[model samples]
Target: MELTSTKQRRAAALAIGAASVLLALFVDEPYVLLVAVAVICICIGWEAGLVAVASAGLLSSVILFSLESGAIGGAVRLAVFVVAALALWFVIKIFRTMSFYDRVYQGAGPNIADIPGLGWSAYPDGRLRFVNPAALEYVGVTADEMRRIMDGDDYHWTQFVHPDDVEASMARWHHNLETGEPVIDEQRVRRFDGTYRWFRDTAVASRDEHGRITGWYGQMEDIDDQKKAETALRERERELRLLVDTVPTMIWLMTPAGLPYYFNKRFLDWAGIDAVKEEPRGTRQFASHVELFHPDDRAAVKAVFEKSFARGEPLQHKGRLCRKDGKYRWIDSRFEPLRDEDGTILRWYGVNFDIDDEVRAQESLRLADERLARALRAASLSELSVSIAHELNQPLQAVVANAGAFQRWLTADPPNFNHASRVAQKIIRNADAAAQVVARIRALFSKTEGAPHAIDLNVVIREVCDLLGDTLTSSGVKLDLHLDPRLPATTADQVQMEQVVLNLVRNGIEAMQNVSINVRSLRIVSRHQNDGTVEVEVRDRGRGFSNPERIFEAFYTTKPDGMGMGLAICRSIIEAHYGRLWAENVETGGASITFSIPIRAADSIHTITAATADSRMGAFRD
Candidate 1:
């Protein structure tokens, strides 16, 4: 389509040239040809105009020669005409070029109006040459006013910049202009409404063929919304940072590789001035940070952290941390990984909570418990000694009475031999009985057993209940006996078996001390198992053991003043009789402690008793 337009323009120029030539030939007018040449230049460009001038000069020469003029005179006149046409072409070309450039410089061209944002141009000397219509409208100024402002001073644009930003903006602009570098800056500019909004101004120098800057063309982009968003984001970040710093607990942030990067205000304060300064950069590494833990805990804490980091797992560790005051306090530190959508670790966030008070309280309670246990043990030993003394007193008193009777018989006026012999026999019997009682006491203390005997567990339970009847009444506890009348007696140490029942019954009664009176019932059940064993169970309606298995451990107790030895001793006695003792929490309520011992035949009782005694002795030695 452009080719067609060019052809048409050339055709019009040729037609005008032809008409002018014909008019000149007929009217003999040179002024008409000059006018035609000027018309071609303006309409069809300078090349077409020059072609027309050449054709006119040749035709004028022909006319001069046909009129009987000399060839030299005709040639000279043609050359003068050609020279004049050439001069006219040069002047017209120069005028067109200047007019086009002037329109562009003034931002009067249609293309300049189509440009988005505020378009501008400046001379090489950093003087504003033109501001586009959009730019003039944005600044709320007319073309004439802007032109005046631009001409008024080199820093004329500073008037539109924010007051606080003017100095920095001017400095940057001048520096870039002097260095002939690209202009890039962000500053707040006044809008048409007299409100300042952020804008980014960028420009590059337009260089000529010699690499010298001719002008600077640039654009101003409205970045008000962007700047506002950035400012708001920064404000939110500041608030978050403040919150983290002011939190009571210590907080820290680390890289995925476990390098500490940030510590909150609490952490810095606790770590002291040296930490605040981040002196010795290595202190931020995992190993270096672990050094802050108590020497005894450093290795374990480091290992935990390293393992957690390598596996991208959360970690919790309780250890002592060295404070700035040179005191070590218990700190519970927890670390968790921040992960992305793909389950990749991005960072680690950690918190350290001071648990020194809780730890110290626990330690103090443990020490108090140990002291109480020792006191209870002493009291128990003293009680056992009194019981032993009471047992010996019976036998000793019997012996004294029998000895006085024998002495009286022997000292009688006439010696009563039969009566004296009978009295002496009684004294000997009492002495043997006293010896047996002493041996039994030794066996009990040594955790050894005497000869096995056939004894009904129901009888033992009844004896224990009778002994604790007063205690049960005082504590408001009811006793429920579930004895199997048909149950066969088991062969075991009668005394040790009685002791087991006694301990279990007491434990059950004590366990119910806190229970309501209506429900504070201690039940003792005895049954003959099909597996040739006798089972005894002590059940109570009370708070169950927290850890049923741990209750049987030596020195473990729930009561404030308990020695924690009752269950232990009971278990040992049962085990010595080749029995199994276990405890369990009842689903309905409370707990149950049960022991089962084998029912051996009467003939094997002696062998079993000897083996049991040996077992008990070995256990004690160990």
Candidate 2:
């Protein structure tokens, strides 16, 4: 809508006059009043372009009072300038077909205060700048407080650093001087209110064209949380030592490779020391412990260790560590490799227990087993001797009978060569039978080399059942298998599984020792669950679990001779397979021991991977 004549121009003048009244009354800036008059004149350009000067003169009548005498207040001045620019714009847009109000009102100004997560710092030359606002907030201060801190003439940066770390900072500063390298240290820095907290600071040498050092550009960040955790760990170590000392056993902590980390007070006593002091440390942790092992057992110990240490054998057995005493003592020890979140071995922590009595018992049992085997062999040989005697008697008797036949044949002058050949063949067969018996006895006693491969839980169960097929039948225990058909194979040596399953089923048989002949049952079941895992549940009926949770704890058991390690071993196996194992009472009767293994997918299941940028199905750009 354009103004077509002087009448319209007069109408625009009235509007400016009204705005001027408002500027003098509610508003403070006279410039806004002048801007309104100028806008009226500009709009009337087609009719009063020559008389625009008079309108400009008329714009001077608005301002009466102000925050600034002869000048506008900061707030009023800013608004006035803004309004004037908008009024000029409004006049220009009136010539266009569309309204300018829509565009002008839609756009909003940027917020300088909320620039976001930005910190500010200034050089020594009084440039007020934003340092790490994060560090500022962490130190519990505001930007204004920071300004006061930098300007404070009394306090230096190191004055805020913790006293304990001050020496380290000084050392770093000296090193930076010599090497011309950046000085970085984690220490405490002072706050504006004179409190100290953890701060990580770095000072890098700034160089010019000539390569001379200008000034250092420094950065300080708070690391109080990390420092607090470190302090907690230090305290924890002391507490752990105190706890180990309280235990009666010769408790020694070791690395996976039999290296000594440290020993408790009990271990120190066993080693003939009063109390192990800090630097002499009684034993430098790790590799050093290996040097203290009994000379004769070292090779055997290291070989057994290599099986699990070098190549991770699912932690299976715990054995002895001979102490400071020359006499060999059985110490139940286990190694658990300390791996990182990515499964890389960072270190290991293990414990050793005094199991000298248990070792003696095992040795005694082994000797007894050998003696029993010998006695069985003797009995079997005695039975064989009786058979041999019978065979010899029959031959001697047959020879006597055949002597007359031979004489008859000789008299007839036709030799019975076919009969002689048949006798020779029979003698050869009898000799071979004796040799086979001897071989069977030798095989039963001889040491066997290991045959190992990846094991499937389903296959393992079947094999165990098959191996004990006759034993189960004789014991009157029926084994019912409900195995999952599609269990993914595990990277395990089948021999280990053989040992574990054999032990478990044998334990099951022993568990059911109290079951009457009318109700003997052992069930081995396996299935792939909804969580994409394969599970094996071994259930038996006899006496129910006392405490299923406690059963798997090392050195916990009901049986007198039961090497409390069976359930513990099962748990270790399950965990090594990156699985879980636990025991729970069945509703009907008895207890069920269950183990589950993750079904390894075709690829790793991380949100991102090395090839993720090229992923066929994703929004990640390369």
Candidate 3:
């Protein structure tokens, strides 16, 4: 049983027994109250706490006085004694606490006042110089009884010191006298009856000016609770370690300063350090474990770490790590900077993922895509030349017709007036439209590029839609346009953007190839957002896109007898202009190809990139 608990139970029993006996006596013969008074005196030392021992003694004296004065209410008087004893305990507890600070500064090191809580302890040397009032209360004795024990006693002091600590305490005293040093140990102390309490003893010998040893000073603290907690912690560690060591992936924990505190056994085996169960020396630090990385990949990996140190950002990168057998493998490492409540970096923690297989697969796919792109571009210039000629024929014919009309007007006695001027304007507009198409093709083949400039959205729409206007009419396809008059200009390559619109229109027309004439229609719409973005949407009344997510994959096509590069190039051009391009099946019926470009002024005079400029979101909002 716990020593404190046993002491408290005994104190309770004594209180009840004394109250019962005093009540029976006073109720029968009033003179017997005098005898019951002696029992109170015997129990006076029960409150042997350093702070309340004196107060308990004084209150016990009151009960004795009451009995001498011929008081018949002995039990009620003792109830008053308990209340008065508590009042005195508080007063002395506060006084003792204050005196403790005073004594600490006066070179009388800590004494009983050093212990503020009600815990058990006894004088180890067959004497009671300072017993806390709480210790007295624990043993069915009162403060007056405790003072008598302090002044002089045999049975009381004998029952206090446990048998186990008596010899150790004696040996420590002699050792302190001989060596002039303190002795510290943990042992059991005897309670009032037969119980033992756990305690941690601290004793030191005083020194003189000449370095000579004087009398020893000491304290014994209760440690049963601390001992129990330590035992529980050890058991928990075993369970946690068993789980960590058996995980499929090797795990490690490192300090923010790059020190590794733990590495499971699997991690040790993976690193090829079989001689030691674990590399205790290397496990303690990040730098110590650097030798495990492939030397060639170290510089780049080190630079990636600057984000955490210099910018206070997270550190994340995939780098090669060397195994014990000198074979280097890749590991995806991620470290996040930790900060204190005040926003100061406290440390960084990290994790690693083995992504070697994923990395190899991506590299393989990249090579295959590059080869396919090369094969597609290897198309014959002779064949392209024929197609270009066929496309250029109609514009040439219009030019010829406009010239003929002008000549006829010149030959007329009276000119055809506005007819010649309008014909000449048409000639110029058609020539510009043909030139813009050629320019788009040339720009697409350029090696270097520039940021998009402000372009009139309506002008692009009208010219391309008008060029395809005749084709749609002849193909029995209906067209609808909803253009915003005050729509803001877009920052995009004009001819490239036009080609995108034209391509979508062509695809829409193709989807309606076998549809009823009434259903074979395309609608183009434009709207200006409050945020400086203009959206262009091409809606068709026919078939929808298949697998929208995969549709944007390079070379993934929806059309047969088509290069499939057209829509891909359109997507690239739209994205390059800091615009978004996507196709989704509209809930109504068909697919909608919607794209949007920022319509704001250029962010800066210098060339700008996504990384170097205000983001698209900011740019559009601004």
Candidate 4:
């Protein structure tokens, strides 16, 4: 279509040229021919117009000379006309090229106006050439106003930029212009509403074929919302960092693989500034901070940490950690993995809490317990000494009395030998009894009690009552014995059982010693329970026990000169026989101590024997 149009224009130009030439020849009007050339130059093209003007000049020159009159003058006139026409064509061609470029520039204006953000172009000398409509609108300025601002003494378009950012932005822009490098900066740009917003400004130099800068094309992108969001996020991170640093405990963060990346202020302060350089030492490995842990605890702590990290498990360990002062103190270090939604370990957050005080307190408490235990054992030994003295007193006194009687009988006129001999035998018997008591005590301590045998608890109680008969009578305490004749026999060490019954009976007698003679009565009761066990209760009308629960505890006694081992030993003996002993205050204003022994021991003969020995040992040791 374009080719067809060009051909038609050429045809029209040729026809007009022919008609103009004929008119010039016939009518002597050169102005008419010049009019046709002007039309071709304006409508068609310079090439076509030049052809037509040259053809008219040549044809008019030939026709005028052919008249044979004044040929030179006609030829000069035609040559001048041809030169003028040619000159006109050249001038018109220049004008047409300029006009076409002007139209193209005008067309680009609307396209630039349609851009979303601020856009502008600058000359190579850094002077503003054109500001797009968007840029002018954003700055609340017209093209003329912008031009005036650019031409001002300042001449950098800094008026529309935030004052605080102007200096730096301008410096960067000048540097880029000088280096012919791209301009890239972020700054607050003032808007049409007179409010400043963040924008990212970028520009690149447009270079010509020679690699020289021709102009600059740039764009300002609105980043106000994004910038605010980023600022807020940064502020939030700052606040969180502050909180982590200010907390009292030491804190640290690590990658999922257990490489330490961050440590809080407290950690740095506690571990010392050099701790920051202590990297590659992480949860799985402690090569760098090995000295941070006590030598005794470092290996164990490292093992625990490595295991926890390998399994992505939470860790907790208590051990000594070295402080900046080179002192070791207990620390409870705990670390837990921070996991994503799919349970992938993202980071490990950890803290170390100082537990030195608590650890020291616990050590002090342990020392105190040891001291108390030693004290208790010492007290038990003292009580056992007193108990031995008390046990031997009776037999020694009897031996002394019998010795005196034997002497008296021997000195009587014709001293009766038989009576003296009987008295001597009594003395020997008391001495034997004293030796037996000593031997029994020695065996009890050495865990060497004789084998257990089946014995009636009632019989044991009866024997104890007989042994304390004199004391009961002297104290004016009435003794009521309610023995269960049907009581079952239980297997136990006979001597130990005898000791238990004697202690209980003696305690009852002593309990009522300070009471009124009339009301001071002791009751000894025995029963055979349905549970295949024999039970005996010794009740006293003396002052009830102040502490029923602690009465069985070693070294606990109410009497001024009493050995606290009595009930403790008795309970141990009964328990050794598979029995239990307890004390309680009776409602009738008396204290009752009862013991029950299983009818048949559950243990073998050897076990019961060992148990009896252990029970006696425990009586003093406990």
Candidate 5:
């Protein structure tokens, strides 16, 4: 075959065109220069040639028209330029046709067979026409052996396919031949050594100018390593799936955006939700899961989930999750991020466990505490009933006496208006006093539901001391009060707070009953602490507690007749109000029980209306 040099032709044509441009510029004989330009353009090639010829024609006309020539000379020059351009166009047409055929011939050379992978071609009848050395090597066969196999009466190239893949391969081949479409498939082919390896084959239908199929040419790439890797990965995935299903706890897997995609069997059974079946339409898996939560808890769960998803943080939420039977059960759900080596979250892994029993247990304990508090209050009120009645009785008798005296004065023979007015004033005063006494008694024993409210600890101490005044007098115990009027207000249940103060004062009085009158001292003090708290202390100059700490424990006390719930209830109340109640032995030979309640933040404290309490009383009359 003779070789054609495109580079040599290109250089020669470029030089000729340059010379023609110069000649057209300097020579007055524009027609001769135009002919030379046309020749150079035609030799250059197709589309490029047409552009060169047109440019040359324009340049030649520009030079000729600029010459000092008559009309005949210009017309002749124009005619010559037109004829040369026409001649270049015809030559370009032929050159284009020849170039197309040359490309086709070059594309058919043996270089394609030397491609990295296996290469082969087939006739329209699906018979192997050629197989490259690479293809034969992959099949572990020589050229002669491959030919011998192809010559058999019923044999085809598919005979070299693994037995398991031969049927499908043959079917696909036949389909390709009938439809004149491409054949692209992956299958295992048997080598001469009887070992099968995977290969990916792709063949496109070779067509002629009429677009009719003539043959098929394709390549086969060894994909044995890739197939083995995929198989191993699938096996590992199966093992992981089996392990997930068999585990006891409910588990789920979600995308990094918190959309659940996988759920273990236990999770499905727990909520009666299967991710594949119960998935919401055109929405994320979380949409379906959000419904599983108790309606009141869904918003909280979503808020936490979104925050955690955004921050890549772990989330723990406890809420009621709906069961298949329409009942809701408490579940403790926790989500942890599955992170890569760079600490980037790839997905979210979560587990949920039933915690209904634990929640029920906590609720039961709370109810029990409430009942115990009520019982303790009732017991304390029983012990103070006599003193409380005396406190009210004296005021009531005075009102009765004063009213009687006022009536007598009004009925005087010569009515003394001034005397009657004085008597009436006394009657009103006594009645008001009686009402106050009753109010105090009722407030101390009030049993309304307990709720926290801001109150002055100083006032609570004074009221408790006044209510226990008669008891103190009868027991020969001298009561002392050291209250700080400047103490900050703290939040707590008023009734419960009073109960705590009263319990401590009563205990102090009882502790001093065996001492001498002068020595029996029960001192109650209220003061402000530096740490934003109001402290109340009840100190008794009596037998100190052997173990102060143990006294606050439930059902533990020193008194024989004691129900042992007073101090315990007091401690519970103080703690519930976010306060500290503790006891210590005073060095001088008494026990001091001090409780400090934290003052509420200014913004959190509200001025809610409650029964007014009197902080001062003159004396307790026998």
Candidate 6:
């Protein structure tokens, strides 16, 4: 009976040890697990408790190993389990002798406030419960003095807060106390130096076992530098806003998806669109903003804006906008995306430029140019007809004289064969001369019929030179052409440009007709200017003009028989292409006539079309 009782006691002890080990292994809380381990060690001794821990680890390893397939994985998991179990054993053994609640109380008690920064605690009545040594130093007062200060009915802390921020700070503090919410506020406080500086105070309510409020626990951080920086930034933003509103151009800002958010005062006044009142909630709601644009231009402007916004591209478009006085005026609107450091777009900044006057001026200039071109064409046709008649008359008179001689020789007594043959040759030569004159006239008229295209200035100059090869030779003028190979192609009426060059060359030849053959030199140069325009210069070694500027005027002439319309027509053509034409007298006694046409953008089909559009969009530099 004694042996059976001893065996039963041993069995009971084993069951208790097994129960403790299982509880320690499965319990979620560390303190509870430590308590269970302590109970096991006390009941079965540390040696036996270690054996139980190893057994628990072995069980955990077996469970983990079952989840993995490879031997290496299983071994790693077993080693991990063993190390974790050993570590837990040490922790449990070390902490088993200490009280958990006592350590927690020590950590969170008033003693914890004796840290590097200012720390404090307050009761439910908003009275100071505790203040650390650092807090006393921050407030420039001793513990006794702080206690005395808190004893007063009015909060002494309020006296330290900036007078401007005192009321709001106190109201927030009272609200936090009543609602049991965390207090987080930045307020200016009087420092030890008697100067005000910003401080960020954060506090949360400390609760008791019954979840009742105990006290307020918090830390006060010096944030004077941060507050100063924030203030400066706000001031700068205000200044920038003022600048934007006062600027001549209308300015606005929108979200990345093109929803208007801000409009400068100038924009609001001009557009008459209240950005605040017309705030959009979604993409569909923003479509109503299109009403500010003219009905004819709305669809096109909206399409361009949508495409640019969606693709994160810059926006550029010209459209009519409704003004405050119910008048529609043309505007050049541009949108640029504002992006963050990582290149993520944050918002869109825009500007609307009033271009109504500029557009109207351009249209008027265009109409005036058309009228001038018609007048010049009529004048040119009349002069050309007279010139053609004179040229044909000489060749026709020669033909008539030669034919009469041929008929007279053939009719004379039985044909003087050799003389008749000579007369027939003379007749043939004059007929060929008249045919050549007709061909040149046809070529000139054909050029006037064709439109402008992207053509090389060199090619045009060479063609003109070929047509006037005989004329140059007859006038004893040496033609020099220094064409730049790298010259960009110009968008111009090839025929008109050729005609201008021809006129200049002819004028040069005429001007030097009285000079010696060796000195009568005509130089035609085609080159690319620094400003990205194609410049053609026709220089002559002749009697230079006294007033080069007036030479370009209509019906202004230097030569005795000069119509003076040549230079005028040339200037008008150059201006139509957004180019400039000018003449200057050379110091060495000659004239240099130069015209520069802007090179086509390489992708445009028309010369003046794209250039005119671009010029109307912020081309005026201030």
Q: Where's the lowest-lDDT run of ten residues in candidate 1?
A: 613-622
Better model by lDDT: candidate 2 vs candidate 3:
3
Report the C-alpha lDDT of model 2 over 540-572, residue by residue, as the tens digit.
887878887788764467997654555664565
Model 4 reaches what TM-score against the true structure? 0.64
Off by over 4 Å in 6: 1-111, 114-117, 150-170, 209-211, 280-286, 338-343, 378-384, 407-622
Query: What does each candidate score in C-alpha RMSD?
Result: 13.4, 28.4, 18.7, 11.6, 21.8, 23.6
1-622: candidate 1 lDDT, tens digit per residue:
3422334656676788668867877877554576677767866566677787787677766676676358887677667777887888888878755654453345533576566788888777777777777888898987657755754656678899999999998888889888998999999989889999898999999898999988888899999999999999999999999999999999988888999878888998897635546744324667767788999998888888888999998999999998889899999999999999999888899999999999999999999987886776665565445545744664576678778889999889897989999878877866776787677667655645356778888888886686566578988988889899998987877666766787788788888888789899888899999998999999999999899988876557888976465576567667767789999999999999999999986667665544544544333222
For model 1 the local lDDT of residue 531 reads 90
Residues 420-469 of candidate 4 have per-residue lDDT tens digits of 99889878977877887788777766756466778877777776676566
Instruction: Provide the lowest-lDDT 10-residue window in model 3.
Output: 613-622
Candidate No. with top TM-score = 4
lDDT of model 1 at residue 197? 87
- Between prediction 1 and prediction 5, the one with superior TM-score is 1
The global C-alpha lDDT for each of the candidates, from Candidate 1 onward, is 0.77, 0.57, 0.61, 0.78, 0.72, 0.71
TM-score to true structure, per model: 0.57, 0.31, 0.46, 0.64, 0.53, 0.54
Badly placed stretches (over 4 Å) of model 2 are 1-181, 186-196, 244-246, 250-265, 272-303, 307-311, 314-322, 332-350, 357-622
Q: Indicate which candidate wins on lDDT.
A: 4
Q: Give Cα distance to truth, residue 273, candidate 3, Å.
A: 4.0
TM-score of 6: 0.54
Q: lDDT tens digits, residues 1-622, model 6? A: 4322323554665676557556645652122233344445544445556885666566656655666688797777667656665676766656533322222223347466455566767776576556666767876886546644544433675766789989998899999988999999888888788998888889999888998888888888888898889999999999999999899999978887888777789988887766567555434345766888899998998888899988999988999999989999999988899899999899988999999999999999999987887776665667656545744664576567767878888888887778879868866766776676566456444422224477888998986686567678889889999999998777676555665676777778888988778898899998888888888899999988889878877657777876565666566556767788888999887889988988875445354433332321111110
Off by over 4 Å in 5: 1-108, 153-159, 253-260, 270-321, 331-350, 356-439, 447-544, 552-556, 561-581, 585-622
Distance (Å) between predicted and true CA of 544, model 2?
A: 34
lDDT of 6: 0.71
Per-residue CA lDDT of candidate 5, range 1-622, in tens?
A: 3222434555575677677667757776566565555555455444566676677677677777888468788878677777867675676667655543332222244576576677777666776666777777877876656654544433367777888888888888889888987889999988768888899999998888998878778888899999999999999999999999999989988898889877888888777775566555324667667988899999998888899999999999899999888999999989999899999998888999999989999999999977887777565555445445544554466567667777888888887778879867766755666575566456434522223567787787876666556567779888788889787777765665776787788888888877777889888888888888888999999989888868876556688776565676567656656678999998989889999878885445332112211111001100
